[model samples]
Target: MLWAGSKGGLEVRTSAGGATVLRGRFPYAVPTVLKDGRERLREVFEARAFAASVAAGGDIHLLVHHDFDRPLASRGAGSLEISDGDDALTFEATIAPEMRGVSYVADFLGTLSAGLVGGISPGFRVAEGGALVKRDSEGLLRVVRSAELIEISAVTKPAYPQAQIEARNWTPCTAAEDRTLVHALNRWRL
Candidate 1:
């Protein structure tokens, strides 16, 4: 839990099946200025919208820097869950191998052993993107609308203040086939 009451940071946890959970502050509410110069707080990915997307099975991935062009982890074999816990949304899913064939799993294991870098973020889209009013100790905010989650990735900096990532399932790539990786890479270069 991050920033529920005071702890302003991220919490990352690791489990079996290459499971990784990223928990922290999300700028679900953002401040925007209207044409009249009035400020409005935009809400992207509120509770309801998030729930629907998960039910719909939106495509999600674990990547570096939230980049969609490439992903480090494959899509989950099962449903992915993003729980709105405390002040953070817990993005939980299993990181799959790039694609397994021959020693592919071994190579994938090597990549995971190297570990990920930076914070966590989610890429999603809003439906109606409506607005709502809410009052808090921080201030009053005109939240725009919620969004549907696409992919939760390991990013540099997310909307809010903090984020963290946790990835489990580590195994050494000691297959005799590893020795032949250089030949494969050389072939790929060609």
Candidate 2:
């Protein structure tokens, strides 16, 4: 069992998973304002009033202010790279050393993958090296982190579609997948 206590900053204790203590001075806090801002963005786009515009691929108006606490605040943008696809959109964000210890984004992402694979079932293909098989709306092939793959489809779809994908399934990823994910996440750092 994991318990969160407000000791120094935010300390958590787990039975066998080891305790996590977030304290001392850092560039930011764990539950920083940036996370809240991201949540607000998701909420605004999910609002019913913006349905029509969102469906048409129009930009949702952002009423909230920028995340000033972010180290990349001056950049005013995150890293993104994409190539050919039916209609591919790739997003990448660089996390500084301070941000790395902030949250287990990969763990959160893994939970998301389990849910997506559970819902979509055989549609997902977890490659040997930890890449996930993903296809664009037009059926072009691309690989990404499982969680990002899930968000691409799940976040955009009006409703969950039960249809299965036709692609061949890849081998299951192993414990090494976690290491790969961390490397990918901190590519900029390296």
Candidate 3:
């Protein structure tokens, strides 16, 4: 399983016309802990691990909590743009007002604007021979060298603590509404 870092590197911008743009960085080279049964392991993505996958230009989606059914934007639709950076995968997604009309989507947007969404994470599958495990001073270390990037998501909890989000030009939810949305989002985990 793949684990994402903490929530601190996301930004959301809404246009006067109601188009919401979500931008964030999915960082590499940050170590996160993963568990396989009773064994604990340290995992980190090498810099540029996602370069080939992003360069391939495959269709990818911006989702909430990694839910396929809750996609907010898609690369194939020209609404999601991804770029491979030196140490992270950066993405910008333009969400139309029409798309936000979907019940869950609207809720997500509101929660995001209210600063309840945690951070962004990448959903990916490691390629063959793309990861190497070695013994380190801390214990077992898994270095991911390559992977197929499938999707990016806004999550309520993160394992890595380097991601962040910001909302601009958007109306924030009321305190009562924020509380309710937070309750709802906490229950909708993956």
Please, what is the whole-model Cα lDDT of each candidate in the order they appear? 0.40, 0.22, 0.71
User: 70, model 3: CA deviation in Å?
Assistant: 0.5
Looking at model 3, report the run of 10 residues with the lowest lDDT sum.
164-173
Worst lDDT run of 10 residues, candidate 2, spans 1-10
Rank candidates, lDDT, best first: 3, 1, 2
Q: Which of 1 and 2 is the better model by TM-score?
A: 1
Per-residue error for 167 in candidate 2, Å, reads: 28
For candidate 3, the TM-score is: 0.80
Q: Write one digit per residue (lDDT tens) for candidate 1, span 1-190.
A: 0001112333545556554443444433333221122333222224343555555654555545444454545445453455653244555544443333425334433444454333555554333333455655444444434444556655433333332212101112234523332322221100
lDDT of 3 by residue, 10-117 (tens): 888889998998888878777765543345566777888889879999898888987778999999999999999777888899999898779999899888878888
In model 3, which runs have C-alpha deviations exceeding 4 angstroms? Answer: 1-6, 35-40, 163-190
- The residue pairs that clash in candidate 2, if any, are none
- How do all models score by TM-score? 0.46, 0.20, 0.80
lDDT of 2 by residue, 1-190 (tens): 0001111111122224332211111111112111122222000000121122223442211100111121211113322111212222212223233433544433433333454212211112233443333433433232322211211111111111222121222334455653342322221100
Could you tell me the lDDT of residue 136 within candidate 3? 64
**Cα miss at 59, model 3 (Å)?**
0.4
Q: Evaluate residue 12 in candidate 3 and report its C-alpha lDDT on the 0 to 100 scale.
A: 82
